[model samples]
Target: MELKPIKTRKIYEEIVERIREFITSGELQPGDRLPSERDMAERLQVSRASVREAFSALEMLGLLEIRTGEGTYIRQVNIESVMSSLTWVLYMEKDAVLELLEVRKILEVQVAALAAQRANPEDLQNIEEALKQMYQDLQKVRLGEHADERFHFAIAQATHNKILIHLMSALSDTMERTLKVSRSKLYEGKDMPERLYKEHALIYEAIRQQEPSEASERMFAHLAGVEASYLV
Candidate 1:
């Protein structure tokens, strides 16, 4: 039988893994300061650049907070953010990207329904504000990716389920990247941005009117359109 070659990791990735182990083993705690880059480099027997690279990645994952004058400290762990960052790296293949969209369709359709039935005034206001932002971006011929993400996140918040909110947070970064790619493809059709905005408007209207089924349907349709654009 033929064997596949072992994959080699970058030095910075190995450093990241080591720091993750430290956190997992309780050697690092929230608010605990990390060693200086020089110290870490000497301890790890690697260059300072690798340690700095690892620290930057950790900061992006919300696992570390780097203050300008105060140095780097462990941030209160946002497990969801960490998971999402890992997931983003692992699922960059075409089939994996489609799988991510499938997961989104499953979770978001139900999330829209729940938001329709349970949304408070504040939740509605947030969703409307995101929708307004989308329109503003469209008027300026921009992608409005942030507003699109905020719109869906606001709907998830409206569900009032802590677990669902956490799950959405975990998926947020990956979804944002997917949307940016899909929107670029869709915008090639000129009217596609307007079409997308109208679809979001319909979903919001259904939720605002407390129509769970309609909200779910609209959300499903919107996601299907995105998937189609991505495939194109």
Candidate 2:
């Protein structure tokens, strides 16, 4: 008896599983061309759109690569090859953005703590320069948005954690959104910039002294203030 058409059988998930099985069964080896849309639709008895969507989803995960003007083909599995797309997904989702910020806050608190314990003359000078930029930008009330990102990234560098850098980069887009929302809501209040300057300075002092715990506390306080201002 002919198998029921995949389209009428059940959910897209069943389709996804069947496709995955086909790949693993060696019927669709890496670099092998997939059937054309018309052919696939006839074989599976599914609409062309569903096939296209499943193909797109697989391609997005870095499992399959689609060449424009060319047919779809199976792709070789490689972890290094997929990092950029995976990282992008981390920022593209709004809820992921909020979760990333929460993760960043926890990491930043620890970063400040570490910087406080290990910062040298150069680290202190670097952080101070960032502070100066924030200060100057605030006095002008223009909010140098690019400088703002640089300022926080500089602090992350001071932490000397390469892993943290990767994680933060994944969430950078989300952070930018929070910054815009916060500014739109509170810039008119005018007190935010000056207060943030003082907070940054206090955190810097703790780091300059190599006092990890104090630095962490100051960072938590600063982020808490930002959260209350924007989220509450």
Candidate 3:
């Protein structure tokens, strides 16, 4: 009975809140395979990727079970576990947040260059797949944060360095959190998403052409934009 319309820039977070309301109200009972992503997105007037991201985050928090090919279902509640995760995220400081971005820049810039130089056909395909998803989401006016993460992760994987891969995997959650925080600011302008997509395309083209320097430069420029939007 407490549900309200979502009117926030943080679309995925709002979707999560709404779904959580459904589950808590027993409207979506345990073992219920929730609506398809397309259906929920249409009903909520959000994008499918936003709904996907919301479900992904809920799965991480153990509140939902997403069975591949079947559907998403409400998991048994674990109040303490959920609260602990929320508390840990709430405890992060601004300085610590910036430090996370700093570390990402240090690693990902080199990763992009290396990927341009060393990526095999399969690696290129994965990166392109992420890029394709991003483009599709953007066309629908979705933020595509999850696809952005996938694009970066593809670059990291292309490095073929286990240590770097492990590092990126460990930092994924923090990176995702930072992206969510900054997306609204970055996309405040009407044309920002189109510009962002073009930037990403330039980076992808550089990598495709095996131009390491161009890849690094494009990656740096993209991250610089993120920094300016987020920190300034």
**Candidate 1 weakest ten by summed lDDT:** 1-10
Candidate 2 per-residue lDDT over residues 1-232, each given as its tens digit? 1224774543444555566667767777789888777777677788777778777777776667888889988898665324444464554455654566577688789878877766667777888888888888887886655555665676777877766655555456556664566555654566776777788889888888788888899999987776667665
Model 3 off-target regions past 4 Å? 1-94
Clashes of 3: 0
Model 3: per-residue Cα lDDT at residue 9: 89
lDDT of 2: 0.70
> Residue-wise lDDT of candidate 1 within 60-129, one digit each (tens)?
8788899998899988876565675565454454357778888889999999999999999999999999
Instruction: List TM-scores for all candidates, in order.
Output: 0.68, 0.66, 0.58
Q: Write the per-residue lDDT of candidate 3 for residues 47-97, one digit (tens) a residue.
A: 889889999988877778999899998888765435534533443444577
State the displacement of the C-alpha of residue 141, model 1, in Å, after optimal TM-score superposition.
5.8
* Models, CA RMSD each: 5.9, 5.7, 13.1
Compute the lDDT of residue 198 as modeled in candidate 2: 87
Full-model lDDT for every candidate: 0.83, 0.70, 0.79
What lDDT score is found at residue 78 in candidate 2?
Answer: 61
